[model samples]
Target: MFYFLPLLLLFMTASPNTAIIITPNEHTFRVHQRAQWKILLPRDYANPFDPDEIAVDARFVGPDGRELVVPAFWFIPGRIESEPTTRVATDEQLRQASFTVRFVPPVPGAWSMMVKVRDTERTQRSAPIFFEVKPAPPGSRGFVRRSPKTSHYFQFHSGEPFFMIGPNLCWANERGIAQYDEWFEKLTSNGGNFARIWMSRPNQLFETKKLGVNRYDQDGCAFYDALFETAERHGVHCMLTFNNYRDLVDRDMWGPAEWPNIPHNAINGGPCTRPTDFINSEIGQKLYRNRLRYIVARWSAYTSVACWEFWNEQTFTNVDIPPAWTRDMARYLKSIDPHQHLVSTSFGANSQHEVWAMPEIDLAQEHQYFGEGVRDASAPISAMARSLWEKFDKPSLIAEFGIAGEGSDIKFDPDGIGTNMHNGMWASMMSGSAGVGAMWWWDNYIDPKNLWYQFYGISQFAKQIDWINQRFEPVTLAPIMSDRSQPEIFADLIIRSAGGWGKSHGKPIAVLPNGQTSLGLPQYIYGTEQPRYRTQTILNVGIPQPTKMVVRVGKVSDAAVLRVVIDGEPTKDFAFSGLPGAPGQTKVERHPEGKWQAEFHQDCELEVPAGKHVIELRNEGNDWLAIEAVTFRSARSSQYADLETYAMKNEASGDVIAWLHDSESNWFNDRAKKMPRTISGARLNLSVQSGKTYRIDWWDTWKGRVIESREITATGGGELQLEIPPVHRDIALRATRIGS
Candidate 1:
């Protein structure tokens, strides 16, 4: 009979007038649980999404006298298949349309709600409806936010830390919602708690509606309703990116030609005349603001919506997003979102530093893709994340990362080992990043290959660390081998230069018959590392072998000279020329002004002997040469052990976590090697409080469980030494102070 108590209360507070119908999902809601009121409006408007045409909102007054003005979103109810394997709603028929006001009750008490409806001319409000909220269930956490105690890490309203540990489930395939169901199940079951999703273009939300129209698609809205519901069920927090810059362009790495179909194109009646105008023009901003309103109204109530990202790789758009637009949108979003979720935007690797430094940007995100000549993924991943945090003084996230941008690692790794994917997750989390790096290629690689286990170990390790209150600082450790000799660390280093080739020389030397300016090549300038056409790459000698270096060159003027300097030695100009002088010159052509013949697409190689070296590449020619990439390959196997280690320690307490990786076990070398090079005897020295006894747990990364445990007390020098176990590829160690 206790079950009927809520139904009885629902009937008591609701008015006798049948014209205003209100149905609650529960008789009594719990704190942190969604309190939904499905109301059947007497009238229907043609465009419910546009608040200017018609608006519906609910005024909720909590027990603590806090008034929440929440907007009611339109909903077309439908039923999903019971226990279905896939999540497609294609066959289902829609029921009568209604408005839904969803809110998560913060405290346990009596709550009152009133629905207000407004049309073109008049406004009407329903009688106040009453309800009750109970205490939240055990272990239930509220919304996520950047911890006030620490700006770099996230915490729940319940004061529990939130460390994201999942990949990018950007969009669904033909199976629709069912695909997310399967993916989320596998991910969450393996300890994943976060996913990055895109709500742009043909695959997702906005494309289902007419381009440029203020109206939103009902079907798209339904998809998200199910998506959030599924995410909540699986305990996965979602980062929904509103725009994918590729949707605003005619072509991207994905491949394309049809600009007419692009929603942002002027031909589609969008406000922007070109892709670049989307971020700068006044009209574009108006439309974008409308879209933001609809987004907030529809999905802001969900506890699973962890972050609201404005764009995915906005730097890859036709023109980089200006700081003004970033500031305006972020401020606007903060104003509308009642929950005040975290906000951020992604950018191409090392691009758009000026915009990220703004105070409005909550998190600085970097997208990394390793192409040819880059074999080790962990070093660059750690370096880039650390660089963003250092430069911006905010939390950083590697939003999108993979071995290759053009394609998935499946082509190269048919066995589906996912070595880079594994290494990247460990590296980013230990690099003082907000959480694990969100990897790309989810559809073709992560899902199809069934690589969910890669997330397990890190999630297990994260469970033991309190990221918010601990204030962990990142540090590196060097291990000593049992043979009393330093271990060999190999790396296939990649050095990237600044700027592209064939840019205009600003002053045109001549005018063509078609009335176009004939611009000459820009003059080369080389002095220090900051000067144009000159860059430096620094690395310590890890292997006792000569490093193979390759330089990619494009379009060199006749006077263009390639110079290389090593370890303060005299500058040695490579044997290369533009006009029939370079040995590997494949093509030489005159510019539009016919100034001189210049070489195009040439490669220069050099071998630097083993030792500590500072290599610098400079162009001391009359005209510039577009140098794309410089690669240094160093790999050799010896009868010694090399472990790459990164750790984070809490200074107040002697609590710390460390990840150790095999030096030679990169994507390139691991595939070609026959047997696993196992290191058995090694010693690692870590910094801890003097004389503190700490319990150490050694974990098997693949299995995600502690294999062994021991306790050790630090010496007078504030150092604790651990005898390392056998490491096949990688391992993790968690040390906790016994008394602390």
Candidate 2:
């Protein structure tokens, strides 16, 4: 009876373990360009299972269709696992199993892996599970790198400046993956090269206390990994923000406790002070380090990583913590991996002065939201950058700069947004600093019509600049003016080459106007009297007679390399100096009537000579200069005004206004389509007084429709006049509201 009892017990235990078996989980692996793969398992399987105890081995295949085996080893679970695998008791009714495998796919392609589990006692094996791998798609293609020894900009490979033309994308998880995909596609197609992905603190990625067990529990991490994979595939780089303002230690880490607080206002609610030895004391840092280590070690092998942003707008909050804490955290990251990738904080400020000064920082990042009327804030901001460059002498990048636009108004005058960005970029580039132009609300929040078009324009401009860097050598210039007076006179020039001699043999020059005058270039003398103010006219010199000269005016940006062609021929390279020199037979001369005119050879060609031309005379090396209006002439005569002429007529005023046409009156006729209706019939009459500015607002009741609004300043009369468009139906008028 005793012997039979022992055998019965053994049979019972073995029976449960033998009958309950799990087949390998089938997985489809898809990675984009420059991405890697990693698989996590349950904690029970931390140690390798005996071959006889398992049904199948986990194997991964490469792009070459070859199988690669992962080394099996036990790892400390840290905060991810609560107990050691050996501590877990096994019974016949159930047995726990866990393990993990990691692999980095070098290129884009379909990949497969097989997972099988074998039972030794039963001599049975589970069916093989298949998984696929994908590479980074067309638009996405870079990764972030971090270093401790130098600032973030130095981390980027020299000559390969990381230019991110992207938007601030928030509420990603709430938006879901499909919307994310569409947004990514739109941004990438429109010339956006990167996305700033946010990860709130107390999120699932940091919940696990142990590695294997906790990693398995990280659904958020899994979701983001998928998104990262998608971004990589799309050729879009991601600046993954570690935490948002609400999730920080100094703020409410959980819930919307401060919902009513104004958006950029600083509110300290959470435990702002962290332990001195956080990594060694708190369980969270260990988990954080582990997760970060895993992330860095895995993602570092891919080229898609352009930079690793530490936090988003952390400087805005008044967190009571020593600066060394951040410094240490940065040091810890660099110790694990030293790659040529930039590491920075998504902080809003003149980063060149504050953040760049931190030993832990690489690039200077800032966010600008200057109001509408003060459209040219870029000037001062850029001037500050120049001062910072001279002071710190480090590489800088404008991490963020944008404007709040309702719709098409913001799009066209995106100059309101673009000018600031363009000027900032110009300042950075001309000052030898890396520039990152940011678009706010391109996706995720405000859905604007022609949003993609705006992005495309910015992207094209950036690409042109990039092309310039590839083609010509970059030579920086000193600011022409040190004072705020006559900002229009400051000019930044990039000359292709120096020293020229003839009409056809003169060097070509590219000029970017910063202030009123054309830098210090040469001006013609009409009658040897000093000119009162600098003008946008080219002064002729060394001419013996009144002669016709072809002048060209074109848009030149920091992001593009432009080639100037006179007529059908290219111009010779020339240096960009504040002073102009006489070339070849080109001479400044007075007419028989004692009037001076500049002349070019009859065979000289001109590009963009369609606009009206005027002649100006100035004295050589003297303050005397005079402007004379000449007859408007063009090679192709036409009475039609250019598009700019028409647009200038409808420019917005201080008060809110809308452009409505009578083409479609449904917007005016449909009541159900109007809610908080700000637009209606072709003619919109609203009571607006003079000297007041109103905000234009609208809502689209349709499922995926968009509503737009523009503001018009009141001319001081009791009635507000507006040119309405017939595109929309119902309209509601609201007085301008200010002061929250």
Candidate 3:
């Protein structure tokens, strides 16, 4: 009862009994629209779910006879998989499946494709099938890239700078699809053009799935179909990220990324013994290439799919040495994709090894976190962006970042994790990253906190910037914090003198009737010079040091000894010898407990490790000693910029971008608390021509709107000043040279 259509039967499995179906034997599609060629066959003929075992390609011949080969992957419709264990596709339901390639014609006119299917044992070909294509809709320029313009920015194939600014959104359940739709629609309504769609891990994949190992499921593909359709309608582009590290996250026997949950694991009756094994094994390579074939054939046709990122933080996996694997797979992707959409890989670590700097990557990607350092998250963000943007000298992206802690302990604040998500985007933009930093924990943090507005604000700022035509370079600026006498002074509010807080300082302390009062921080007591204990000192004295040194202490804890860390390394039970006496005195003292305690009357002599040293005096639980005085036998060190601020000028146009950043907690959105005027007054100091008139526009980080404007003439050739407005969050500015 079956009819044989051999003339155009370009692809079929090795088995002669199976049937192959090609829909729309003839076709017509507009440019940038998909033309799907589907080949269906019985399960006996090929492994529908095994991309490694089944490979197909359709070589489309343009009007001028230029053939562009596009691959095809398996797809079969099924319902969404949810909680409570269940199976959607029965063996009979998977008997017949399809290999599909949805390609959008790059150019309009008459076109034809020669379909080819490669089975494990044989290859089958189909005769030419002709089609016609039309021009794309108005206002559509196509996929993003950096070709045709060698600038440090991403531009569409049509050469418009694609300054992307959006969150990393993975697939949401049906109930949440509406939310996603609204998010995408709103983003477009406010000028956003880019986002990242994560494929998630094995058990959590919403875009790709394996139905009982040998058969594929179409539900994931269907979700993307509607997702991409909606994206095209809203003009939102997507960065389709492949397997995240969670795929092989085998921390335990059963968890979010358990081995049994991953169908591709060797224990699950598939290829590769471990998570890292898949990256370098031959069988793993085949499976990966097969997935690429499936993805490239299915999604490459649409301009909406911006780039195919192979891995999300590859280093997060056991594959610590993954650069080679990255290079291999990246090269494979480059060899297959027809549209040549960008190809990139992100590292969980702040930076990539030199191998990542290879040409295979289109974007130098990095992820950053805050709270560990004394500075705010923005400082590291701005540094990572500007650093990689210049070092790679290619387009760089802060693919993932926020105020979360590192590794498994990462915390996501449903309340928005302070203004970190806000500041990260603005800092990244002005720091010269190819796009505003894409926020992670999209569903939990971005959506719930309504942080998407930050992108809209970033998009607004981006629209005003002609990053495509006018390239810029970040300029070195003066330190945000000039000088520091003591480590504690850098704190927002320091208790230097115990005379209680001065009246000018917010919330004055209570004064006693006897004309004497105590500040909450005893160290702040005036005149008496109450000691501030538990301090750290990191220095680069820049000179060689002797084997012994002495420290003088004005205050002490009779029983408890402090820890003195040296040369960036910490040492415990560092008893002050209490010898060499005070800076000007000489004496030795020992307490009843036999532990040497630093005395005000003597210089506490301690052995100084040779070479450069960074000293730290930590209180061992008790109020041990104060950093009232330190007599380092070596020279004193200089101060580092509390913030890593920089500026860049657009040569073609006289406009400039100044990025100033601080990683102070007061700058963060903590427990929904707002920063006070004390957190204000941050500034951007950049090199400018003296006497030149410049129009400066202060940017609001969260709102992405201008807060104020001023015209200032540079007073010197070395640097010029622009004050940060009184915003609780980070700030940026765009300066245009009017005249000299």
Report lDDT (Cα) of residue 521, candidate 1: 18
Residue-level lDDT tens digits of model 3 in 1-740: 01122331223332455445577533558776667776765434334445446667788899987878887776554443332123444444344446677776778899887878777877778778777788987776877787556557888766677888787776565454465588787677666778888776422343222333333335555556667777877888888888776666776223446445555676766766777666677767776776676677667877788888887766666676467777887888878888888888776753454754788888878765443211234544565666676677688888877554433112434355445666667767777888888777666556666656667666877888778766687645444533345352211111111111111111223221111112111221111121332223222232234534444444454433545566546564544334335343233466554545444533455666555444544445343443333333432223333343446676544578765544344333354464432344445565666667888898775566788999888785735676666544356678888853
Worst 10 residues of 3 by lDDT: 495-504
lDDT of each: 0.70, 0.37, 0.59
For TM-score, candidate 1 versus 2, the one ahead is 1
Q: RMSD in Å for candidate 1, one decimal? A: 10.0
What's the residue-level lDDT of 56 in candidate 2? 33
lDDT of 1 at 584: 67
Candidate 2 regions with alpha-carbon error over 4 angstroms: 1-162, 201-217, 249-287, 297-303, 338-340, 349-360, 384-395, 403-433, 444-446, 464-740
Ranking by TM-score: 1, 3, 2
Would you estimate the TM-scores of all the predictions?
0.81, 0.44, 0.70
The list of candidate 1 runs beyond 4 A from truth reads: 1-25, 39-46, 78-95, 116-127, 207-212, 257-259, 262-264, 485-536, 539-562, 566-570, 575-615, 619-640
| lDDT winner | 1
* Deviation of model 1 at 228, angstroms: 1.4
Q: Which of 2 and 3 is ahead in TM-score?
A: 3
